[model samples]
Target chain A: MKTYTRPLDLKNGRVDMSHGSGGRAMAQLIDELFARHFTNPILAEQGDGACFALPVGAGKMVMATDSHVVSPLFFAGGDIGCLSVHGTINDVAMMGAKPLYLSAAFILEEGFPLADLLRIVQSMAQAAREAGVPIVTGDTKVVEAGKGDGVFITTTGIGVVAEGIDLKPSNIKVGDKILVSGMLGDHGVAIMSQRENLTFETTIQSDTAALNGLVATMLDAVPNIHALRDPTRGGLAAVLNEFAQASGHGMLIHEKAIPVRSQVAAACELLGLDPLYVANEGKLVAYCAAEDAETLLAAMRAHPLGRDAAIIGEVIADTNAFVQMETVFGGRRMVDWINGEQLPRIC
Target chain B: MKTYTRPLDLKNGRVDMSHGSGGRAMAQLIDELFARHFTNPILAEQGDGACFALPVGAGKMVMATDSHVVSPLFFAGGDIGCLSVHGTINDVAMMGAKPLYLSAAFILEEGFPLADLLRIVQSMAQAAREAGVPIVTGDTKVVEAGKGDGVFITTTGIGVVAEGIDLKPSNIKVGDKILVSGMLGDHGVAIMSQRENLTFETTIQSDTAALNGLVATMLDAVPNIHALRDPTRGGLAAVLNEFAQASGHGMLIHEKAIPVRSQVAAACELLGLDPLYVANEGKLVAYCAAEDAETLLAAMRAHPLGRDAAIIGEVIADTNAFVQMETVFGGRRMVDWINGEQLPRIC
Candidate 1:
């Protein structure tokens, strides 16, 4: 309970081994950095963990986890901090649940700048606050200098699904209509441009935002939606393929209808990457009954994060579970899973 | 749904960027290693997250997280994988909860051997199985070759406490008794010996274990337990200081009553370390009413993990909230907070 003799030098200080030594230094760092930004009653208790009553009518609990090792911790539109929070929240939201809490675990390299750490924590707090989900618990560990990059953040989210809303890959029927929440590949292209130092006629920014609110809007309009997922690491190609395989069906989509901003499309073309295989951080693919497709699309398009929502595909019967796309050039090609590493540390 | 053309070469394979790209290689590694080991019904779904019904009587949920960055991934008695599981489980159990599930997120360094990764995952699987807590969800990310050490594992646990049990540091009264579960410094000494290449007359092993069962037994007998915590980092001294600070009281303990194995004590002595500030992986400290201390100690001793349980200290009224210990030679010394790092990456 005794305060440290000197305050942390956030302006010019750097993380050291003592910051993670489970001693006074660690306590000081927590009090000054983490607890200050993530100000919540539960975290203020500073117990071994956070304990709270599960929300009532919590028919089922959803848990999701993601580890962000994005290079160049700061990106165009977002940094790893907010991305870490949004990514896991979207995962839980994909299950037709309301995300309630998040737990963050940070692995920081020794000698990393404390200023950058503070910035990241502040962004995370803001993102969590905007999403209405507090980061209730967290942990911090420091690795030796060369043993780690600047930092890697792992976030786990807990959400509660309402009684009658069940969204799963198995629920996708052969005739379900497939719709995308927004444009594809903005996140990947933005990160790629930053890494390659490429200049484009137009600037590209990562489409990293929490999708829980958008998902809630869509689900409210179409509660019986069959399945939903965010196209993150493996992009739309991976998600479609996963759904096809899980449902023992095939997908036939119109590439022309899939929303892709011209800048992202041009960037992917110049980089020799398929937009289908590029990541999207703030977008989702939803499957619903054919009769409800228009209603669901209207709901999604009304949300800012899903303004470009479009129906791009429909499920079909195919024992092989192939995802065939009708190209914009009036041809068809199998939009297969990504073959190898198009991008590493792309979040 | 289609299997890879070639099975993963688990023996000679080294993780490359492709293994974490959310592509075929990543799928192959997951299918061949992680899925094969941590086999459970929930993880088998392989959704974005795992969704399950909360336990019916789940009065409140407790969540805890820890990131493991221990040096020499493998040690005498445990590896980072099992240590990560036991550490978080103990945290949740310290709150008088029954740990129900765990989520693991791994940041693997590129070029790390797949064999070692498999070993760690196997150990994690066995530990979770033995503890009766399933690893229900997880994620994996790869960093460029030199950007990271072999691997860092972060585990988050979710548990449900019974209706009447409410354990928090604020519950510690001025007259509460403090008891330690078992011998101290075994874990720290074991790791120190490995790092220092010190050969002792007696082999010392890390006391890494899951203490949920032991916690359940003790709580069953003493539902009114004031406070409980596991002394991991910063050891017993840190726990006492934290308790004193949090409860606005001082802690006075008899050094003679505290148990320390001779080998561990000798190792600490040789290393110029104090047993009081050395970590223990599988131990806990509990606070109870003075009159119930004997019953609590007896209940703890009846459990296998608490064979050496002893009432080592008592909370006293003190304005400064200092933690003082009575030495065997009739001298009193302040067991103050650790000011600097004793051992880095000791966890």
Candidate 2:
């Protein structure tokens, strides 16, 4: 039975096994870190699960989940905290749904620095608040040292689409156009640069940002959008290849039209990698009819996240459903689905 | 190009970093393990997110999430997989909701055996099927060796409660009767037995099972149940204490009336642990009107999950809101919320 008037030791303290023990220490940590940062009415209720009132006709609800095990924990543009929130939010937005709420589950390693843990938690809160979503519920666990990294976050997002909006790859037609929101490979390169033994990076920060606002703006201009996808894990190439197979249409792209930052491009060259197949955290790819492409591009360009947007490719009729990319030197090469892992733990 | 006409090497294979690379290896792992087991219509669509149609007036939806980081991977009666699914399902059911779907995310260690991973996945699929819920979406990540345990899973569940059903600790009244579903301390003992340095002989095993159906059956019998909770992390003592504080009332319970297996009781005695504070994975405590207590007990006893249901406690009016317990030796003691962690990583 003791009381003290000192703040939590987040500067030089480490998370021991007791922080996640579901007792006084765990409750104290939650109160000082999670509850203080994620201050919303729903989360404040602090029940076993969060409760919310859904409107009568909110239409289809979409759920997406992603586990962030990114190396280095912190990167140039963002850390695992914000990346976890942004990743799942983008997944929900790909369905043309308004991201509504999120749940975060953290697995912390024993003896991890408490200061770093608080930093990540605040970053997640900031990201969720910026996107107008709340971390309504969460769970935390701690494993034995060496049994886990500093922390791994699994974020699950729930969103609701209006009654009339339908976005799916099956809606792609032969003459549809493809566009990307911004440059690719920055997020991946930023992490690779910080990895052990890799050291060639020149201001190639991660393009990690929540793209739900951009999606909403695009929908405002083109409600009849065909398909939308975030070029995340396998970059623009992975998303485009999936779209081709899902839609049963061939895709032809001009490599010169694709956006790639000069620094990231130089780094890819030094590492003998393909920027087209690298990862992105904030960019998106959209497929729409030829008539709506210009208007959608204009709308996307107006958004800060999609300023460098361009129509990079078009859908075509082909029985083989190949994703063909015209090289900058004028030869066409088949951009096949990656055979193995291009980049490990890219997201 | 190498194609092997054989199944994946679940027995002898180790998970490399490539398994989580979001490329061909990752897709193969999903197809071979996760998709093959969690076969449902919505999951087969394989979009970035899972979309579901919500009826117009389906009432309030409840979402719950939990991360399982149990040590020793496999324990008596259940492993992390079944535990994860049961844990989240019970959370939603505690709100008197019927679980509809679940999403799982896995973080695996780089060099963990593939066999263990598959076993956990299949167990999860079995648990979901038994609960009549589907695993509609999932994500997987792998960390470096020594950066993770064998695996950690986070399961998030969504459930919908019918109109006119309300269950909350806030509803408890002074004369309300408290009922427990079944035995306690078995699960905690079972886990402790398998810890690195602990060993004992006992038939007490982890009581990991889905309780949504039991919740439904009880609702059919007594729709006016005031409160519901599963004694998982801090056990029955923790739950009753929470109820007493939340309802602004005191609680009185008889130690002799509580159900505990003799073997489990012996284990607790040997381990110097109290049965009231040990966790139970598949038990529930219900608060209801004193007049309806017997009928509700009868209804619960008819269900397998609650065969040993007993009325063990009652709510009382006390300004201090203390949980007073009457021991078998005819002595009274105050059971307070645990101060520090009673048990670390007990769940």
Candidate 3:
């Protein structure tokens, strides 16, 4: 077997027509990179579509689909491949389900670099493996250059939710406790550092990790959690506003309780972006009964991804659906719904 | 109920901030346009998300998701809304399934005309109803102007594939008959004609439609159809190429047997486009046993949408995986895979 350990020349190489040609080159690329990294039985089957038996269960299946179109394809701390898997998995997990399978569709620019695409595919496979999900089936298409950005990925995920665990915004009560899984705005800052002419020096890596394990741990600890939401594109503020409106309740938060890394806060301050509105890929907002707050917080903190978790707010009775934050300086300020896109294509 | 009879001033009106302000203006827009058109029980509920029960079934369910980002928002015959629904429903239906329900996620650019958005939504709802598929759930988010185009709609569809159908490309045989549902290239041409500087003088309307009913009729006529595919973005050429590769067989298409309208052919000639590479939203390609081809064609022609149905070709024995077309002038030519984008922003 060939080791295929050559590092890709990312700077000068451009994608060529041969990459999409289903020949020896395509086979070499798939075997050396895709197969090597995505070492699962289904992918190894090498069929036009993967076939697998569903897990035996009485639970209802939850399904979700997401498309990834982030610019530059390769981002700081993560790329489109991992982002695609993380996104759909989080969508399914947000339903308080165990994500089981994923289907990916790729729209490749005809001249997209084969090396870069291989790397991206490898990253996606690794992410899926870490999340304990399988890439069950996929479709690939080559679009003409300039017709598409380098690569666009759409992923659809299916998961199973146990019976009697009805998690919905309708389940939320006025006295429910709101918790943040970890630090905010890291993913946003990391992407901002890569933008043209807006360079900043910070080791802020994207918080783009699979959160299904953390979600499972939290759900195991508190099965009756009212609702779970991942703050992705529009960030924590947008999520809170949606939750408040959906649950028909007001939210009061202690700004000090929300965890934000110092570097992220500093970068946001420099960029004139609000940390609250900046995106976070590896974090979630959990709402549960006030009595289960402590138990949930302890369970969340025990997980690797949720060590800095904190009780951020509480739901209150009000048709206004206002989300207010008590500033560290002993004053309250309204955390309004995000007015518009804070940073385009942050996801 | 206030009836809205006045035609929309699409050309002169500019979108305003009030469109997204969630006030009386928004209500008028929703009621006069969206609600008036959609008129479904679930949408009438007017919750943030529509909730409904799934139909009982023992068949394996197939789900597909698609996002529409076509330029010009409104097209020749349809807009993003109908296209989004049709696209995903066609995806699920291609798997030999009965499309059941859909979930839509809308990312609207702030300052988009409330009337335009409503028009698109209403069109989508109408399309869903006409197909007997329900829009059961949805989410809407408003992005700031410049961060997005006018609007982008993502639709997720779920359907159940009846047992014993066994539709797969792997089942395609060397002697299988190839059948095309209708004339090709109308949808792609209609979109290209509206492009700036690529002006044309033809009343070409898009063939954008949901194909579930047509598929159902075909399945009823012949359940053992080996493979079914929709020739959309990369058109008939791309789809045939994929099927040929998947089945590890060669395909020979008869040019005279394939259906193409005069206007579509003329437009493709004028623009240097191959009709085989142009898209057909409402059409489909079916492969089945040659003995059953006549029966399938008869059932297809009985339907309104498939009146122009034809037996285009047959699979051939070849490890080279070629798709060859017989020329109109009695010569053979390769109906090779599309190399580049024919027209951009075409759904």
> Which candidate gets the maximum DockQ versus the true structure?
1
Per-residue CA lDDT of model 3 for A63-173, tens digit only, reads 666667676577788998999899888877888778877777665666687678878988998899889998765545444565456776777776777766667777889
Error of 2 at B134 (Å): 0.4
Q: Model 2: per-residue lDDT, tens digit, A248-281?
A: 8999999999999888898999887799889899
Per-residue alpha-carbon lDDT of candidate 1 for residues B1-347, written as tens digits (9 for 90 to 100): 55888887779889899888988788777778887898889998888898999799779999988889998799889999999999999999998899999999989998899889989999999999999999999988999988999999999999999999999998998989999999999889888888745665348899999999999999988899999999999999999999899999999999999999998888888889999999999999999999999999999999999999999989999989999999999899999989988878988
Score residue B320 of candidate 2 by CA lDDT. 83
lDDT for each candidate structure = 0.92, 0.88, 0.76
Could you give candidate 1's per-residue lDDT for residues A85-165 as a string of tens digits?
999999999989999999998998999999999999999999999999999999889988999999899999999999999
TM-score of model 2 (CA atoms):
0.96
DockQ for all candidate structures vs. native: 0.85, 0.59, 0.13
Worst 10 residues of 2 chain B by lDDT: B1-10
Clashing pairs in 2: A147-B148, A147-B149
| Candidate with maximal lDDT | 1
Which ten residues in a row are the worst by lDDT in model 2 chain A? A1-10
User: Where does candidate 2 stray beyond 4 Å?
Assistant: A1-7, B1-7
For model 2, residues B21-101, the per-residue Cα lDDT tens digits are: 766677778878898899998898787888999855657888889999877678889999999999999999998888888
Query: In candidate 1, what fraction of native interface contacts survive?
Result: 0.89
Best by TM-score: 1
